[model samples]
Target: METGPISAILDTTLAIIFTWVGYKTAAIVWKYTPYSYPNARINAMEAKLLSEQRFNELAESRTLQNFVVNLEDTDYRDYLTGISTYNVEEIERSLERALAGTYELMIKILPGRVSPFFRLMLEEWDVRNVTSVVKAKFRGEPASDYVMEIGPMLPKVKAMAEAKSPEEMLVILEGTPYEGPYQRLLLGEISIQEFETELYRMHYGKLLSYALSKKNDERVILEEFVRLRIDRTNILTVLRAKAAGMDSEKIKSLVIPGGSVKLDPLIHVEDLSMALAELDSTRYGKVIRDVREEVEKDLSVLERALDKYILERMGELTRFYPLSVATPLGYILKREREIRKLRAIAKLIEDGVEPERIKELVGDVA
Candidate 1:
């Protein structure tokens, strides 16, 4: 068995040759196979064909049945959950959580590459919550404790800083990112009107800026929504000021400059209450129409009427734009509606109001 060095080298070369031959044969077989890299064009065509067929099938089945099937197949079970017979407090809590879940899903599904217009609404909600908490803290009211944590402005810090009067709070906010409105607050000088104007300006300015930055259909919808809301807000502001016996000039000063109702006509009137009626006759005539008797009795009724009117308009918008930013905006509205309904229900139920009455006062079932 003792082999010479040349013989051993020859054996090794033969082994190497056989290994290379086997590899080459395997490569040739693989190349000629149906599902191999060399047949990549066919594979790609087949994949495309399959995808088209599936898409056609989906298109054909795009009905309630398919929707139900998709819901069953996905993590959408909770969306279908309903509150039928729960007590008022329980129903309120459940709806709040559901609304929160809706927003969470919205934030999840919104594309990372989306324009900022789609996010303007959520931004407004955040700012509103933060500003409310700040104002409440300055008033030394308990409302500060209920601030939602998701607001853009740091509420806790702002609340702590605004623990003094609103004037002091405005000074505290100076030189920060929110300083512009704070400066305007000092100049506009609505001491008797309170700083509600400043808050409105700050929040709406943020929304307006965000909306203007985008140039598309989404931006159009969002901007319209903001404009409508601001108009309604100005109406409420004027009505409230008139009811409170504030002078016409002061009330006009509080009006946001670009709203539907002009301050020029409003400032000319001597009687603030009469001015409010004239203003309503022209602009918000419809909302105050049915409540005219109530307004004559007490202007406070007009404020509630305006609130309901605003909600109705917002509800319509929600219906119109379900798949857009309007959906999440609807969630916020729904949550607020639930909270108000619960508060109303709690007070009425304690008064022994019938369940039927409770339901009627709140709304129809979803």
Candidate 2:
């Protein structure tokens, strides 16, 4: 045999071995990782929760009292029963407590390595708490009761909660991820709404950075999910801004970058129809097209459609990739939506909102 042929054969064999080893190592790492995800159980639970019967039962609830009674047999019974009163405000607070408790439980059950993702997800709660505190501080009202206790940012939230003034809160936020948003607020560079939007932008930026650093199949899935989320968010922002009659520049400023959908055309559109037309060629085109009639009925319809789209996609991912991060993440997202649906139903019931209207607001089962 020629020496060149022999060398080529050996090189090819070594390459195959290395590739096999790399794949095996990755699989082992994923399987043995510290996440401790209860993937199968969570997926099963999600399936049960979204079943048609369960959704109809929830949608047909006649009153907040009735809803609470119906929840007696579900995991939410305790949380709903914890409400001291049937008033909207009390019900809302109890719902927050329930959400916080759920997050805390998730954090406790998940491994430390995987906990960061949940913690990051919980940062929205932290942001809401902080916003409440800052507003209350400015208005000279008590806010400590509004601070949530279920995120990696809890310690900072607590400190900010204690701050006597917005200025003090800003000082506390210094050197943190939130500092820039607060600084912009302090300098009159952005409105309160803009500040909140910026905070969300920052949160998603961090999430994207974390996903990219993983450099694995899980990361690819997560990045796609995050990008879709960003795109939906941008679309909603555009629609809302148009409804509010915001100037083009302001609307453009609110559009977050890095979404899979190109937003440039939509952002500059003079009207909602124009924006929808721009979205006609994107991956989400069909979603917006299907909801166009509903959108004409009320712009809020897009919000509901976007949410449904995201959940549907997540459900698909979980079903196809049961062993991946998709399972647990999909469960978490669906669970959160369930909680929101319950809260909305309770609030609507308290307000004597019609069952049909409430059903519309709650949207599809998931």
Candidate 3:
């Protein structure tokens, strides 16, 4: 068997290709190594998240005191410790503080480059703070009592609260990410709902933009979740506006971008029922259809159904992207769900509603 220089050159070329491939594989492996520590911490925190059964247990408590006592064995205990009355306001405040603590802890423990993802996500809280401030100002009340300390807009919270009118608030809000929403507010004849709608679009639009820019697993996880949120928010806005008899053009203007489906048709629906009917063709159609009858009876039930659907989707998809943004976002959403459930349970028990009925409302939505 005789071989020429061509055969030798071919062998050398193959060797070089294999070496390059090996180096790339190693680089990919090293890129994910930093996720190991934060992933383990997220894993530990996830184990502490309340299960469906635990939510049922919390629901079965006949009194707020019993409900508070039931929470003693969970991670929430630290947040609720030494609270004597366990009043609803006290309980809600404590739950909010606990959520803020979780956000701060996640931000600190996450890899520095990826930490900004969670921080951007937390801006929803700041938007909420602004919502309360502007609404209170419009109503001639102070918002300091209602403001919750959960997001990065803390430096401007005082200014936001001190502003006596929309113009003053707009001045305080100048030169911020939130500036545009108030700028829109300055345009005459905007309802409170419309004002909040702009905030939703700005917040989710920022999140989806940043997620897409990542072009990695963070994009894969956060982008899909953000789009889901946008769709949910848009759908609710349309239905509520239709129910309130708002103008179709105004309703259309409030719709946010980034949904997987076209939501513009929803704005033109003749009524609330018709709006829900319009959803019959979207990705969310099935979830909406499944509860349409109940939704007609109680619109709050529609919110519960949609929240459960997005969460279920997140739970299903995020498993593939673990050790990235998936774990932290999933953990925070699940924690928020638990607090909502607990709040419902406490409020209903105080209202003298039966435990079964409470569970029916706040427990697993089919």
Best by lDDT: 3
Ranking by TM-score: 3, 2, 1
Model 2, position 59, has a per-residue lDDT of: 62
Relative to the true structure, how large is the alpha-carbon lDDT of every model?
A: 0.53, 0.74, 0.80
lDDT of 1 by residue, 1-366 (tens): 667988989999999999999999996554333223312432232232213223233233323234224333322336334534435444344444444554554455543323344354445444455456555664678754545444445454456444556566665566655556545545764442345565567667777766666555446556666666777677667666665667776776577654556656656665555666676656577777777776766765666676566566656765664444444444445445444543454545555666566556545211
Q: Which ten contiguous residues of candidate 3 have the minimum total lDDT?
A: 317-326
Off by over 4 Å in 2: 1-37, 47-51, 58-61, 100-113, 136-149, 155-162, 354-366
Regions of candidate 3 where Cα sits further than 4 Å from its true position: 1-11, 82-85, 163-168, 183-189, 364-366
Better of 2 and 3 by TM-score: 3
Candidate 1 residue 29 Cα shift, in angstroms, is 44
Which candidate would rank higher by lDDT, 1 or 3? 3
- In candidate 1, stretches whose alpha carbon ends up further than 4 angstroms from where it belongs are 1-105, 111-150, 155-175, 179-194, 270-273, 276-283, 298-335, 350-366
* Error at 206, model 3, angstroms: 0.9
Candidate 3 lDDT score at position 95: 89
Models 1 onward score TM values of: 0.55, 0.83, 0.88
